[model samples]
Target chain A: MLLKKRKSKEDTALFRLEENEGEIVLWSENREVSRQLSMIDLQEEDLLVLQKLRPLVKENIEKIVAQFYKNLEKESSLTKIINDNSSIDRLSQTLTIHIEEMFTGVIDQAFFDKRSKIAQVHLHIGLQPKWYMCAFQDLLLSLISLFDETIENREDYNKAIKATTKILNIEQQLVLDAYQKQHDEIR
Target chain B: MLLKKRKSKEDTALFRLEENEGEIVLWSENREVSRQLSMIDLQEEDLLVLQKLRPLVKENIEKIVAQFYKNLEKESSLTKIINDNSSIDRLSQTLTIHIEEMFTGVIDQAFFDKRSKIAQVHLHIGLQPKWYMCAFQDLLLSLISLFDETIENREDYNKAIKATTKILNIEQQLVLDAYQKQHDEIR
Candidate 1:
């Protein structure tokens, strides 16, 4: 009889975020799973909502980038990644454009295509999924805090968060399925 | 009789992941809220997770940043802001760090401290939340996908997620109460 592989709790990983010039990166160790799931595709209404949020989202991205760099200058590991003033300046400009587009929205093809490319990149790098998720979660809290002042009705904001959480659950299922297949193959 | 000020969803703001350097950044228009939050003081466990995920998240941030720049390189309104490559690079790096930090762990005093800072930053910039919670939800999906790959057990992972979500709900309530107090003060 073939024995099925059992999953252990101790084997679980964590998620996190990272900073590169002006952009925020959600990093993870589970590249194969993330890639297999095709996670970034947005529904029609999701796109519409994102489009509506473009202006504020764009501005928020820029500010988050600026502040993050200012903080990183204080860290040693980051110094190796970011060398000088010129490098920082270029990063900020690139980040502004990036944030603008994220809020603008994307179609399914573009989203999936990007995810595939990202998967390829991760495979090349040999990083794991745990690190990425932890970093990304940190990034989410920062963004939420950034927008805290504008949240006039706490109830509505909470409801929006609930909606967001529902979507995340769906995405998680997709990612798990993808990871399982890959793990089995590796074994 | 005095009339109460009616709050509108239009007054709310949204946040998202923007690309800079080789990473992602959290962006939004609402400066006040962003300034109030901070992503710097992540827990040791969270930081460990983020460290592991850095590579994959960085690549995705770079991809998003590149696409954003490609689009902006054409538009007249954004050209002035993104004219220089150096600035773009700096911005990307900054954003990568911020994004890496955001998703690393559960929200706590450190998270709240960062949010307070972000809120202050937004106030200075004179921006507002635009996208509501859609972009945030997308960011969460990316993290979840990564998590699935690194974690070997489904039951343990689910338990962690449930615990985290409950904590977040509690945090949300505190945030709401604070907002109500602030609103009353403004009134």
Candidate 2:
């Protein structure tokens, strides 16, 4: 029975697409799309909160990104990875875009595709999850500090932090999901 | 400066090997292999604790593995994945071997290789981390229950549980590392 299923799967174009180089068609793309979002408990309200913070994020994004790399560069191994696989300038630009998009308050197909692309790129460069998680943790701290520094209302700041945490969780989930998919294919 | 580093990297065979299909030589392999072990803080004492549990684990692995699949089969989506991509019998056999190996309590290159292979196989089959994590969580609870039932000493049980958690964390780190390496290669 499994053999028959494998045979049918092999005969499909999608399977071939997976077999092709530099092309990824996620299995989830065929299933219920919102399942992952639901898994993270990201909702309309969370998106709204993020959307509300867009202007603030925009105001600090340049400073936030600059500070992110400045801190990242202090690690010697990561510095080599950045220098060899990519540059600080390039990473900073990409991260700026990534941060801006996080606050866009939309979870559409396009958003998933972009997130998947980021995950794929990070994976291709052999970025360990340890470093990735660390990098994001730093980014999160900076963002939270932004909230503390700027947001006047405690309640609103708390809500914003919650929303940001959920969004970041969603992002990490995408990266992990992508990593899992590729990890399977590696063998 | 970054361009010079990139150029030098591209000239290396390791870079070429990375670009080639079905060949993965992780960046970590060249560095201190024990780095990941240190990160998880899996020490000699923890290994000793797990070594002590080997006899009990050997006795109950069959039952634990059986219960694992029985619980996993309750998830309809996972069942479909199993039916389509692999057989319950094969997975059960591999998992039994994996569980047995965990108790052997040796952290060597061979052990790391086996764990990496397991991670790669799961990735190829498109297992989501959510299900992977849930399955392991279930497995961990069963292992804890085993300690509860068999170990008469509370201190012994507590030590065993902590060791088990560390071993599992080490296992997970291997899986995540493999995923990250492959994630980078997917592009």
Candidate 3:
């Protein structure tokens, strides 16, 4: 499937930033933003591959999210982090949106902006990178299993998983960047 | 101090790719490379901060690397991995070179190509991401201590450490990308 060029930032209404003051203060807006879409090599082909998974993800998002939180809940420390900073209901809804967004395949400046904001929220909640990375690994495993069961064609399944991995890494990079910025600001 | 724009890919020769067949096969060459220097928002100023630390890193690299490996030696699993894959002396020398490269303050395609090769080597050695990250945290702590003791001004120390962290994260992202590629290739 041929994927069109990414739409202009103004063309997309999906990744709108909230006007909340806490979020504004938390967001690292002044940092010199660069072209991230290129950095991770997220190509139009990768986006096309991801767009194809939209239906698969939409159908299984609830199950996928449930599996993710179940794994997170296995550790008491992670559970405490959630209880202290956010409720399960709130996090579940947010994550469902996040999963759907991954398959939207419409990356733009706003896409990175949203990831940046999420990264800040994670920082505010005192989520350590190790735990975050661990959780993401679990999520990736779940997605791989989902694709394996759902997608019969071997090549297509590989393409789908590969595409998913790239988008997830992009998300993780933004989080890592935010974590570094927080460290820079702490003193 | 004003910094010059990044030098083109051809000018300097710090990060030369090796001609070893194993190295060539391991390096993910056909993968579409992106402008990562921008992706991580690594600027000339960060390079300038790192460049200023060249002498400091140069003088104490031995001590810093010794501390890093000493910390690793405490972990039996890490020691076993080193024993199985490589000797401490060999790894130590490679790490010393790696740490010095971090402070060289030069980044271009060759710089990234070199990092990509290192990531492949790590995979070939069966070094898990968890262990790799744990080791990196130790190295960063050593550098932080080095900066804390040697750099007089608090602000300069912070800038140096932040710059170091960005370059390190860039390296990590490349590894993560390579790891994902390996997973994609595994079947």
**lDDT agreement with native, every candidate:** 0.39, 0.64, 0.62
The predicted structure with the larger DockQ, 1 or 2, is 2
Which candidate has the top score in DockQ? 2
For model 3, how does the per-residue alpha-carbon lDDT over A62-128 read when each residue is reduced to its tens digit? Answer: 9989987877765677789889988899999999998898877676667777877877788787776
Off by over 4 Å in 1: A1-44, A70-75, A82-86, A119-131, A159-187, B1-187
Q: Show where candidate 3 strays beyond 4 Å.
A: A1-39, B1-187
**Chain A only, candidate 3, TM-score:** 0.78
Residues A103-162, model 2: lDDT tens digits: 776776787788778777877877767666556656766786676566544345446666
Q: Pick the candidate with the highest TM-score.
A: 2
Per-residue lDDT over B14-51 for candidate 3, one digit per residue giving the tens place of the 0 to 100 score: 22212211111112243323233333335666776677
Q: Report the C-alpha lDDT of model 2 over B7-92, residue by residue, as the tens digit.
A: 23124332111222222222235243455454344566667667667767878888999888876765678888888888989888
Provide fnat values for all models in the order shown. Answer: 0.04, 0.03, 0.00
Q: TM-score of each candidate? A: 0.34, 0.48, 0.45
Candidate 3 has a TM-score of 0.45
Instruction: Spell out the clash pairs found in candidate 2.
Output: A123-B183, A123-B184, A124-B184, A184-B123, A184-B124
> Against the true structure, what is model 3's DockQ?
0.02
